[model samples]
Target: MLYALGDPVSLVLLLLSFVVAVTLHGWVQCLVASRSGLRGPAAEGRTRPDPRRHVDPFGAVSAAIAGIGWAKPVDPPDRRNRGALLRVLLSGAVANVVVGLGALALLPLLTSSVGSLVTFLGPSRLLQSGIEGDLAARALLFLGLANLMTGLLSLVPIPPLDGGRLLFGLAPRSPGWQKAEYQLDERNIGVAVLLALMLIPLGGPQALLPTILDTLAGPLVRLVTGA
Candidate 1:
């Protein structure tokens, strides 16, 4: 997502925004897990907002290439507590969206220099958002957009991502579900499939991940920015 920009300054701004967004996503998940009564994240010092502590190397590469990537998995202190599973899993996404909208909500409050409607237009227009926009404001635009996109993208029902594991945890106990989970989660099949979807441009509407983000992330931007 940040790579498409022709301007070096814009690219740098976007790169920082993306890194911060991904870091925030992981930190929030860990924070939520700690607040939800899980101690492992806290015990391991994963609660800090450090990028080194959270960003997965492959996930970072994926974010640069596909615009939708994830952070390192945040597991509960006790994975046996299935009830805590939903809270631990869903918090990451909720954090991203809340941060995204929160950034948008604070836009009008920014110094009028950069708080113009251009700053509110959303991620799609970011590339052509007119270089006159304030760097800080443009960074916020990228932050909000990247967070929203990451939140949605992470929800795709595939393995390795939080959403897929969340679904697997929620499903009723069944031999089929168990076997499928074993193959996808245990055997790494889902990880391979997810990589394919992100790395391969399967063409047309079948291009899956990009299409999903394009279709969904845009409206969120418009809705929040009032554009």
Candidate 2:
């Protein structure tokens, strides 16, 4: 029962951090879209910091279950500007990474002790400690790690993901690329592929999603925090 209950405070912080990251991610995309001359929903106030403006119900649930998820999709006013589309697509991922780095930078202010830093970084300790360190410290660590992982995950090349869209924007208008894009759109296979990757274990005890997050985001977190 204790295991199930498990650090309600940390859970709250984690959720809050995730919401903030997602909100920033969406808002940045909206801002970029509008600035790129593709004004639409974002221009009309969908870019608000409120999570409601950007949260996708399925994406939120996925983030809670997995370590990474997406936000509500931002539509372009038109496909007329390839450069604008690329910028809009990439902005959200950049926002997440920036947020993650910012959170890491703020960690020292919360708790400067090396022990607390180690405790947060250590995998076994991270899961076992729950909300052990200073509230602000732990919260910032959670936010940093969450944002970093989500940002990197968004860069995975698959349809519907930011990286995939960026790739599409860069691809030449050759018939082959167009056919591939059309196939991806028609079958909607990327989401399935992404889910499969997220669910399957990565040749070890750990699941793929968390493992990837830890492997990629962990080092970056350490580098930024100097832990």
Candidate 3:
């Protein structure tokens, strides 16, 4: 059940989660760009911050609707740091996974409190207690599942994703696979876009993904929080 509160706690958490996700996305892009020799002027140690130097707008918006998002890309790192490209490329997805795990850990605390508050607030309040409770539960569930999905999805061996970077890093050493690896990066954007469009018809933001996440998170929440 939901408690009627003037405080914007839900809004705050939502915004914070978005920021965390976007920042990780940006850092990952920066790492990948540097490794791929796509550095902009800023990477040369220029002092000015150029908004233009960051983000693929189409990609970011698509992510937002799809429960994933990207930030503006950073200039590539210095050549000295280039050797760490694979690590950098994978870092964003790694960060997302970490967030997912963290959410799972924290789910009990969030759900218990929200559930209790909703019940205590009673049913006649402006905000229906039961609905609020469900939303809060769903939000926690989404946080964990969204992060997990983002991490896993980005690992697909397509360009602009973490998997693509891993494939490139490994391909050069593999006998006879170099040409195929090179072709992957060239079509990364097209592939990613196609995937995003396909996902949209599968239920937009509110359908199957959320349902799957809630289903996965439910048992864990009940086990930990005794809900």
Candidate 4:
């Protein structure tokens, strides 16, 4: 069955999902920072809560064009609490993982219920034929998968990502570990750029990652829709 404004609706849903995912990512970071007693930029009078303070223009544009976005880096709190820093760094990735799991759990229900509702609506032949429930399913599936990918990728053992933080946090607090941590920070920008470039292919509609996400999403949607 075709939705009357399927394409528009899908676009809206995708954007909304992205915002929600990113917001959750931020919130988790804040919460972890607070819990770990990490002073944020705000604590140091260096920034405000506004996301603009954390916005990276290049990242935003890249995300708009490529669907991979990033937040601006804030100055680390004046008092360096390694534990707190680690928590703040890891929080966003953890949020994404949580959301991804939830999406996967809810997917089957969404697809099945939506499928049935569209069928029951008895829309016009043209509308029904055009709605492309499969497409909608694919879109949502990709959304969930996108979250999962973001979460997993952040865990890569490279500079600036959550994995790097985890590595430093777990390493012994010796001169060698401290030196390694400093090295990681020094090269974070380059590492992030390289990783972002490598991930470009994942953004394509027909990419293998998207296809995998759609496949995983299908069952959850069917379950949700009771199809």
Cα distance off (Å), candidate 3, residue 60: 2.2
Predicted candidate 3 versus true structure: per-residue lDDT over 63-98, tens digit per residue: 444444444324333435545666556666777777
Distance from true position, residue 196, model 2, in Å? 1.8
Off by over 4 Å in 3: 1-16, 28-55, 70-83, 112-143, 173-184, 187-227
The residue-by-residue lDDT of candidate 2 on 66-92, one tens digit each, is 545677767744445777877888788
Please list the C-alpha lDDT of all candidates, in the order they appear: 0.70, 0.67, 0.47, 0.50
Query: Cα lDDT for residue 221, model 4?
Result: 37
Please give the lDDT score at residue 136 for candidate 3.
63
Better of 1 and 3 by TM-score: 1
The TM-score of predicted model 4 comes to 0.56
| Candidates 2 and 3, the one with greater lDDT | 2
TM-score of each: 0.80, 0.81, 0.53, 0.56
In candidate 4 the C-alpha lDDT for residue 214 amounts to 38
By lDDT, who's the top model here? 1
* Candidate 3 minimal-lDDT segment of 10 residues: 121-130
lDDT at 112 for candidate 2? 65
The ten-residue window of minimal lDDT in model 4 covers 121-130
Report the C-alpha lDDT of model 4 over 1-227, residue by residue, as the tens digit.
11324466544554444455554555566656655655664463323344444444543443444443445433333324665666677777778766766665565754654444433432111121223456656455445544554555456555555566566666678999787777766756635553355344565533333234334444543453456
Q: Write one digit per residue (lDDT tens) for candidate 1, span 1-227.
A: 44456667777766776677778888988988888797888887889998888887767767666656777877643446776787778788888888877786666565343333433443434422224457777677677777777788778877668888888777777999989988987797987787678667776523466666656776665566655
